[model samples]
Target chain A: MKILCNKADLLKGVSTVSKAVPSKTTMPILECILIDATSAVIKLTANDMDLGIQTEIKGTIVEKGMIAIDAKIFSEIVRKLPDSEISIETNDNLQTTITCEKAKFDLAGKSADEFSFLPKIEKDVSINISEFTLKEVIRQTLFSIADNETNKLMTGELFEFSGSTLRVVSLDGHRISIRKIELKEDVESKKLVVPGKTLSDITKIVSGEIDKDVVLSYTNNHIVFEFDNTTVVSRLIEGDYFKIDQMLSNDYETKVKINKREFLNSIDRATLFVKEGDKKPIILDIGEEAIELKIKSQIGSMDESINIEKEGKDLMIGFNPKFLIDALRVIDEDEVTLYLMNAKAPCFIKDEKENYIYLILPVNFNVGA
Target chain B: MKILCNKADLLKGVSTVSKAVPSKTTMPILECILIDATSAVIKLTANDMDLGIQTEIKGTIVEKGMIAIDAKIFSEIVRKLPDSEISIETNDNLQTTITCEKAKFDLAGKSADEFSFLPKIEKDVSINISEFTLKEVIRQTLFSIADNETNKLMTGELFEFSGSTLRVVSLDGHRISIRKIELKEDVESKKLVVPGKTLSDITKIVSGEIDKDVVLSYTNNHIVFEFDNTTVVSRLIEGDYFKIDQMLSNDYETKVKINKREFLNSIDRATLFVKEGDKKPIILDIGEEAIELKIKSQIGSMDESINIEKEGKDLMIGFNPKFLIDALRVIDEDEVTLYLMNAKAPCFIKDEKENYIYLILPVNFNVGA
Candidate 1:
């Protein structure tokens, strides 16, 4: 294949597909990126057995051909080349030469036919969402997913789409996070399970203001994201997701609006005395005007209080401080409201700026009646 | 011990000494920070046997006494308290009570007498040097020290202060870095081996303009640094330091000047190929007016040439690319100049910003050849 590409355009095109290239795989072709040059454009593709990525960029193509060169070496060389036009060509002997300025690299490449053919995204059921909203939703709900292999269903985030709203839910049995975003584009309803790494990579690439729109489409077993002239396709994790709606609270015994920063700091301090006993639980003693958090361990005990205008009858509840604090951090507002049912029920936390909610399971206090 | 201190002041004092506190030591006293309150100051001291740190903050003294509390617990509590005046008092039963606004922490304390005190520096012969200069010199030279404990002397940076110049030298046989600073302070000359961590911590805390000063004091077997209300004392590694002067170059057979950014980027790209070859060394073919960098492995081969104006004959040298890249990073100049004698001999790199030199010893590339 013969083609000419600008340094910036070439590097960006290669990097998009390089993430799917296997750094250590038994099959040599999995570590290479297949480059196909047509009359109008050039496509770069890389894939492991489970996931694949393909991106095409405009190039001055002199001849139409294909080859698979080592992704890591080619990417590194292209990334560090001086900002100028680069020329790449493949000889009939299966040797590829990449030349930029006065530097040149000749690498042995495999036949393009040896590469795994990636699945084509032929469906237009794609939906558009603001990049900022999608990234925030992932960050708010992703960390709570289980990281163990024993529970296959718990290792992925559950996504449900219905009535122009995309709902994302993640739970590890200890804590649950739910986020909702209104779809801006017309589309059919769908449901899918996204692996933990897919959510992490999505957040990594999507940040800042939502200047760019996000396009998402899914097949029977894979989901594809097309944004910023790059395409990333990942295999959907298949399992029976939990019905988290059953865990939501239906009654609220007490609710308080307090400064988010103050509550987080107080809970962090109270967590110090919890020494992971048979069951580590921090007790919150609520009064008319203030809430005191208390915990005792072998090393010491602590009592810290924050002021809030409590309205209901004074209540006491026991909770795992870490779970409570984790939920608190997802809120990016000056003031956050907490809805509690009782000492043994799940607690709900939410912020005004976001359409997200966090539910924390309480620990059994067993306080003498 | 009883004292009243600003929340910020107490937190800063505790963090400085707390860095040396042992996370898990067999001796319980070693895991605690000794807190002593006198007429108008509260001193915090912590040690992990190998290194000791002491810092004092001015506060209102309510009672005169001494006690040791768990370092991490106390620091965490103080860091979370409101930005108000914090008062700490000890009860008759030796329970230290910390109060800040509405928060309270009760922690068990051990007697300070059980802690082992480190040797103090003689107060007479302290030398004052520019804090910024000392910090810069340490940053340039300390990167060459070996991290593994296989070599006793190589694990520490040798500090030699004589006449008006303070010289820091470190080497791991494969590479050597030397930095010098001429100070106006007049004091007795001394040579001491300070642990690598001490230099790292000092650099972390000392940063300003080029004229601010820092003091250093030394005893028979320890070095003490006193600056910005923080005192770090470190045990010395006992041995006769190698003579670094004999390693400096008096004349060069050839000299080459190149743009610092260009050379750095080129070497960084070449490092990828070298790193792929079982961590093998890359060869530099230096000739009339250019240098060729070549790396070959079982997978493939890479060859790149960089143009350089030269005055000597052609030669070849083999060395690890990582060593050269590290030495190049510490340089803060637009242009870098290198002096070479032979391919087998050591090469010296000099930057135009300051009176510093780096010597990297080339590997014996052809031992089996």
Candidate 2:
């Protein structure tokens, strides 16, 4: 295969597909990217059985042929090449030569016919959402996904769609995060559990342009996201997601509205007294017009207060500072509301429209202490 | 110890002394910073036997006392404290209370008597140099220090001062780097091998202001650097340094002058074709007008030529591109002269006044190939 492309164009294409290239696998072919030049434009494809990425190169095609080259080496070479036109040619013996400006790299390649291609999934149910909205929802909720592989279901985020609304949810054992967005068009009801790894990678590829929309399709076993010149295919986890609705409730004995920045800063300061392996609990005392934060440990103790608009009864609760900080940081609003049923029950931080919600389990503590 | 200090001032003092606090050590006292408030000014010191740093904290001493506290925790707490006046008080039991704004940290402290103090060094010989020059010389030569622990002497830089001249030299097995500077004042002649670790850490504390000079003193086995309210004491390596003078010679069969940026960039691009465990030699064919760089590997081959002013017979030599790149990147000159003796002898990159010299050993390559 002979193709001439700009160095920048080739680097972009290689990097997009490289996200799916496996660093180590029993099948060596999975480490390579299949370079196909048969069509009007050159296509680069990478697959690791569970995830696949394909992107097109914007350059002239000299001849129609194909080859598979090591993704890591090829990408590095292209990235470091001078900013000029790059020529790539593959011979019948599977030897590839890449030339850019005054630099040339003749690398060993494998036959493209021996490589695995992404599965062809029939477009069953598809939805269109702005790339900006999708990326925002993923970033807001992906952090709560369980990192442990013991429970496969916990490693994925649930995407639930009904009527004209779509909701995304992620929950580890200690905390739960949920984001809801309104769709532009009505679509068939559908639910899919996507691996957190896949959602995070997609966030990297999607552009920040909110005007452009990403077309998403779900098949029986595979889901695809197509936008611009790139397409991503990821396997959907097959299992029942947790009954998250039952865990969330509107019943609360105390509700406090406080400035998001002030609350976040207070929690961050309290963490100073905490050391590695020291699970110190930060206590929050909700009063009539203010919320006080307290942390006592062998190293020291810290206390701070922030003015708040309170409703309902007063209560005190303790929580892991990191969990509270994580939930508050992702919130973009200036003011946030917190609902607490009691010291032992989980507390909820939600928006005015209920578009976003974060529930964190409180750590048990002696109220008198 | 009772003292009132600004948050920023305390943070700066803690960070400077924390550099000497060993991350992991058998001596527990080494993990603490001794705060002495006996004088009108408050002093903070940290020691790890081999090195010690002492700096004065900008604050008012309310009472005369002293205590030792964990360096890691104290630094973190001070850094996160609100931007306001902070008050620290230690009782007879060594329990300390650190209060800033609405936050308070009562940390456990140790007796100041248990902490090891920096030894008082009698000034035997002293030399004065601008902090800017001292920092510059260290940066230009420290990269060549041997990282391996097998040779204790090669891990330090040789500092030689005579008349109004100060020269620093560092040599590993593969390359040697040297820097020479003329001092403004006449100083006593002395020689010391300062550990690479000490030089690097000192670089962090010294400001780049050339107008200010750092007072340096050498005792029996200790070297002290005092500047800008901070003092650093380091134990000099007690051993003979490598004889690097015989290794650098002006006699050369080929001498070529080339643009430093172009030479460095070409070598960086040539490195793309080389992989881990593959020490591919980059061959340089020097001619009358230009120098051709070529690299042939199992993966591929690369060749480029750059314009140069040559003065000797045509010659071919090979070197590890990384070593050449390292020395060239640090050079501030627009054009650099290279002196080559032969294909096997070490090549030298130096200035006209011999203020800076870098000798790199060429990798053995097949001249006929």
Candidate 3:
């Protein structure tokens, strides 16, 4: 394979595909990136059994061929090369040579026949969504997904489409995060559970441009995302997600409107008093004018008050500070409203438009302390 | 004890003294900071048997007393307090209360009698130097100090004062780094080896201002550095330093002058071909007008050439890329001169003013590779 391209263009393409490369694997060939110059554009692909990424760069193809090279070494060399044109060529024996202005590197490449190609998915059902909206929804919900594999379904997020609305939900048995967005065009209803690792990698690749749209096509077991001359194919998790509707409720006995920044800062300060690995909960005492936040541990105790607009009976509740902090950080609004049914029920934080909802369970604590 | 101080001032004092507090110790008292309000000024002190630091902050003292608190928790609390006047008070039972605008903390404090205090050093002999120059000299020589305690003296830097010059030297048996500066006034000749950890901590505290000066005083076993409103006392290593004078030479058979940045970049690019923990050396082929650098490893090989001005017979030498990169990164000259005697002898990198010198030993390699 022979190709001539700019350093910046080649580096960008290499980095985009490197996200799917496995760091350690039993088969050495899985760590290689296949470079194909058979077409007019140069394509680079990397697959790690579960996830695969491919990207194309504009270059002049002198010879039509393909070869696989070690991704780690190739990326490092291209990153440090001079800001000029780079020439890459492979010989009959698969000896690839890379040359720039005053630097030259000779590396041994493997046969392209030994590499595993991505599974081709039939594009029967597809949906189009802006990159900015897709990235935001993933960021807001991915954090709540379970990291361990004890519950296979909880390790992935549920993506459900009905009529014109797309709903995304993730939970870890302690809390649930749900986000909804309206689609530009109506499509057939479908549901799929995507692995958290795949969504996390996609967020890093997308540019988050409001005008650019990403086309997502899914089959029975595989899904494909196409945008910006790059394509990502990932296997879907095969399991039924938990029915979270039963865990949510609309009835509330208390409602409060408070400044997001003020509440976030107060809860963050109260967290400092809790020791590591300790399940000390932050107790909140809600009243007519303000809410008192308190936490006590073996080292110290902290107490602070924040003013809020409330219209309900006074109540006291305790919760894990991390769950509250995580939800508050992703919210872009200046003020957020909270709906509580009682001290034993889960608290709901959502917008008036029902765009996002975060439900957090309360922990039992000693009120006299 | 009772005192009122601004959040910024208290945080700065706590951070400065916290550097001396050991992370883990057999005696729990070593992890505490002593807050003394016996005098009009509020002082904070921390000691770890080997190093001790104390700093005073401006605050209004309402009561005269002292107590010790855990350094980690105190610093974290002070960092997150509101940006206003903070009142700190303690009861007879050593229960400390800290209050700000709307937040309050209650922490358990230990008796001040159990905390170790810094030993007072008599000002018998001292020297005054600008903070900028002192920091620069330390940065240029500290990287050569040995990290392991196999050689007691090599783990510290030699500080020698003679005539009108203050010379600092450090080495790890392979290479040596030397820096010299002229003092404002001549004093008694003295020699001491300051531990690397103490110098590292001092650098982080000093402001590095050209107009301000730091007074350094030493006795038989301890050295004291006083600057701004802080004082740092450290124990010196007791041993004889290595004899590096014999390792330096003024005679050379080959001389080359090259651009520091260009040479550094070329060597850095060549380093990409070397594997981790490998002893591969970069060979330099010095000609009349340019120097060619080449490296070969199990993975691949790289070759690059850089322009230079040579004034001696052609020679070939090999060296560990890290040693050369370290010396080049510290030198601030646009053009640096290299003096070489033979293929096996050490190389000298210095300036015409003789303010700094770096000696690097070359590695032996197969010439025909």
Candidate 4:
């Protein structure tokens, strides 16, 4: 096989797919990226068994063949090559030669037949979603996914689609984050549990454009996302998600609208007293016109107050400051409404249109204190 | 002790001294920073027995006393405090209270007497040099210091002062780097070995300014550098440095002049084929008008020719590209001169003024191949 490619184009193509290459694996082929030049366009593919990425490089093709080379070495060589046309050729012995300007590299490559290929979807059912909306929804809910490998179900996010609305839910026992977006067209209803790792990679590939849309398709056990000149296929986790609707309640005894920036700053200041291993709780004491945040630790104690617009009866609650800060930072609203039933019940921070909801369980604290 | 200081001033003072705090030590006092509020100025000091740093913070002192607090915690707290006047008060029990705007912290502290103080230096010899010159000389030679703990002598740089000239030399078995500067005034001759770690910290504290000067004083076993509002004291290593002068020679069989950027870029490109455990050698064939760099490894081979103006006999030598790149990157000259004896001898890269010199030993390569 022989191909001529621009230095910048080839480097970008390799970097886009190299993110899916496994750093360490028992199988040597898993550490390589497959280069296929059987058609008019060249394609670079990388797969780590559970996830796969494929991107195209615009170049001139002289012949047609396929081979797999080490992802790391190939990318490094392409990045350092002079900004000129690069010629690549592979022999029957799987020896690949890359030459650009006065630099040339002859790398040992493995046969392409031993590498795993991404499973193709049936494409019977599909949906179109704007790239901006999909990226925003994933960013809002991805942080709550459980990092602990012991719980397989919690490591994935639940994606439920009905009519023209798509809802994404993620929970890690301590808190739950939910984001909902309306698609451009109505489609068949479907639900899938996608691993957090796949969604994280997807966010990197999709450009935030209002007019561009991604074509999403799913089969029995695999899902695919196609946008621009790239395609991503990931295996879906097999398990039943939690019944998050039953755990959520609309009933509350008190509600207040507070400035998001002011609330975040108060919690950040109170968290300074918390040590590394200390699970100190920040208590919010709500009054008629102001809310006070207090933290007590072995090393020190801190207190801060911010004025808020309150309704109904005043209430007090104890929570992990990090959980609140994480949810508030992703929220793009100036003023947020918080609902609380009592100090022992979970509190909810949601938007007026109900597009996003964050529910945090309160820590147990002595009421007298 | 009671003092009212600006938040920015306190943060800067604490951060500057915190660099000397030992990350892990058996003695707890080594992990703390001493805070002394005496007379009209407030001072922060941190000493790890080997090195110490002290900086002043302007503040209003209501009471006079001293205490010690954890360096990491104190710096972090000061960084997060509100942008206003911060008031600090210490009780007889050593418990310190810090208040800024609407935030307050009560932290446990120990008596300042438990911490080690900076040793007083007897100024038998002193020198004045611009901060920029000192910083440049250190930066040019520090990279050659041996990181291996077994070689105590090679881990320090020799500072030899004689006849109004100061020369700094460092060698790590493979290569030697030397930087020299002439002082404005002639002074007493002195020689000392400073640890690489101490020079590293000094570089961080001193700003690169031509007008600002650092007063350097040396005693029997210690060196003190005083500049700006900060003072750093370091213990001298008790050993003799290598005889680098004997290894350097003014004789050469071949001499070449080439553009620094072109030579550096070629070496960088050749080094890409070298893996972590693989010590690939970059061979340079010096002719009358052009120089060719070639590398052969298990993965591939690369060869490139760069134009150069040469003198004397034609020669070929091999070297570890990293050492050459390190010295070339620090050179401020547009074109550099390279002197070579043979393939098995050391090569020198120096400037016209003879202020800086780099000697690199070549790796033996097969002559017939």
Best by lDDT: 3
In model 4, the clashing pairs are: none
Which structure among the candidates has the greatest TM-score?
A: 3
Q: Residues A242-358, candidate 4: write the lDDT tens digits.
A: 999998999998898999988887788777777777788899999999888888887677777778999888888899999999999999999999999999899999987889999
Off by over 4 Å in 2: A275-278, A366-369, B124-126, B296-300, B366-369
Give fnat (model 2).
0.65
Q: Fraction of native contacts in model 1? A: 0.81
TM-score-better candidate, 1 vs 4: 4
Which candidate, 1 or 3, would have the higher DockQ against the true structure?
3
Candidate 4 Cα lDDT to native: 0.89
| Candidate 3 local lDDT, B149-212, one digit each (tens) | 8998998999999988999999988789999999999978999999999999889888899999
Candidate 1 ranges beyond 4 A from true positions:
A22-25, A185-189, A207-211, A273-279, A350-355, B22-24, B185-189, B249-251, B276-279, B350-354, B366-369
TM of chain B vs. native, candidate 3: 0.98
Predicted chain A of candidate 3: TM-score: 0.98
Q: Can you write out model 2's per-residue Cα lDDT over B252-360, one digit (the tens) per residue? A: 9999999998888888888977886788899999989999998887767777888999988899999999889989988999999999988899999999999999999
Q: After superposition, how far is residue A310 of candidate 1 from its true place, in Å?
A: 3.6
**CAPRI-style quality class for the chain A–B interface of candidate 2:** medium
Which candidate would rank higher by DockQ, 1 or 2?
Answer: 1
Indicate which candidate wins on DockQ.
Answer: 3
In model 3, the Cα lDDT at residue A315 comes to: 90
State the TM-score for model 2: 0.96
Q: What's the true lDDT of residue B221 in model 1?
A: 85
